[model samples]
Target: MATIVETAVSAGSFTTLVAAVGAAGLVDTLNGEGPFTVFAPTDEAFAALPEGTVEGLLADIPTLTSILTFHVVPGAVHAADLTDGLKAATVNGAELTFDLTDGVKVNGATVVTADIVCDNGVIHVIDAVLLP
Candidate 1:
């Protein structure tokens, strides 16, 4: 199977996310061997942000990287493994709470697509972008 980067690129809906990752210089890292759990936001999610938000973030590497890292957890966590009221710490050092009781909520974003396998990790597509 493809690596995280390749899978994300092929997914087609993560254009903004992929661009942000490249801008943040995190492409190589995500492509590396890692058991990462990524809460991936679709291009629509990025569009939900205010005007200029994406451009501004792209210009600010540190901020962009932090935002990107907030979507990633240290290990691969599949949907079936998630329990109600589970909280996982992200690569950004922030804790993302999950509410599996009603659908699945990571922080405030719902998991729209779960268990997307990648060579280095798993990707769970979310409707909204998560902030740290």
Candidate 2:
């Protein structure tokens, strides 16, 4: 089993996310011990942002880091564990609301794929970039 960072790199769909993580200097934290549930946004999701959004975020480390961390929860929260209206605290010091009523949604981003187990935690692929 690979770490969350390793798994994302191997998946090939999270290129933008991988780069942002590196730029935000969060590669080491996401690779750390214990468990983390990451709502990873795909490259296409990042591309969906405004034309200059990605470039702007890459250059702004603090804001970029906050946005990145907003997608991560402290524990390994699998889809099965999620319930309607569940609120989970993120490493960014904010909370993500789960809406299981219509599929799974985290802060309005649909979960395209769920429960990707990693050596360090789990990765749930989301369709939009979550902002804090």
Candidate 3:
């Protein structure tokens, strides 16, 4: 299996997310030996943001890193590990609350795809980007 970065690259849908990760200088960190649970947002999700939002974020490295890291939670947390009202701490020190009422959601973004296992971690594709 490929690492999270490799898997995301191969997926193609996470272009914006992958680019953002690279821009944030977090390629090595995400490729490191980790059991991270990533709430990955797709290009569509990124595009959903208001005009200039993505460009503004890409220009702000610190903010980009913070927002990106906020989507990651340490440890390999699979879909099965999640429960309604469950709160998980992100790598950026922020917290994400889970809502299982309508499928699965983290923060307010719906988990459109879940349990994408990778070499270093697992990924749950979220329909919306989670902001910290």
lDDT of 3 by residue, 57-85 (tens): 99999999999999999999999998999
| Pairs of colliding residues, candidate 3 | none
Model 2: residues with Cα > 4 Å off, grouped in runs:
none
Tens digits of per-residue lDDT for model 1, 25-131 = 89999999998989999999999999999999999999999999999999899999998888889998999999987799999899999999989999999999998
Tens-place lDDT per residue, model 2, 27-116, is 999999959999999999999999999999999999999899999899889999999999999998999999988899999999999999
lDDT of 3 at 27: 94
* Candidate lDDT values, in order: 0.93, 0.95, 0.95
Candidate 1's displacement at residue 12, Å, is 0.6
Better model by TM-score: candidate 1 vs candidate 3: 3
lDDT comparing candidate 3 with the true structure: 0.95
- Candidate 3 vs. true structure, TM-score: 0.98
RMSD of 3: 0.5
lDDT of 1 at 47: 99
Residues forming the 10-long window of minimal summed lDDT in candidate 1: 99-108
Candidate 3 residue 98 Cα shift, in angstroms, is 0.2
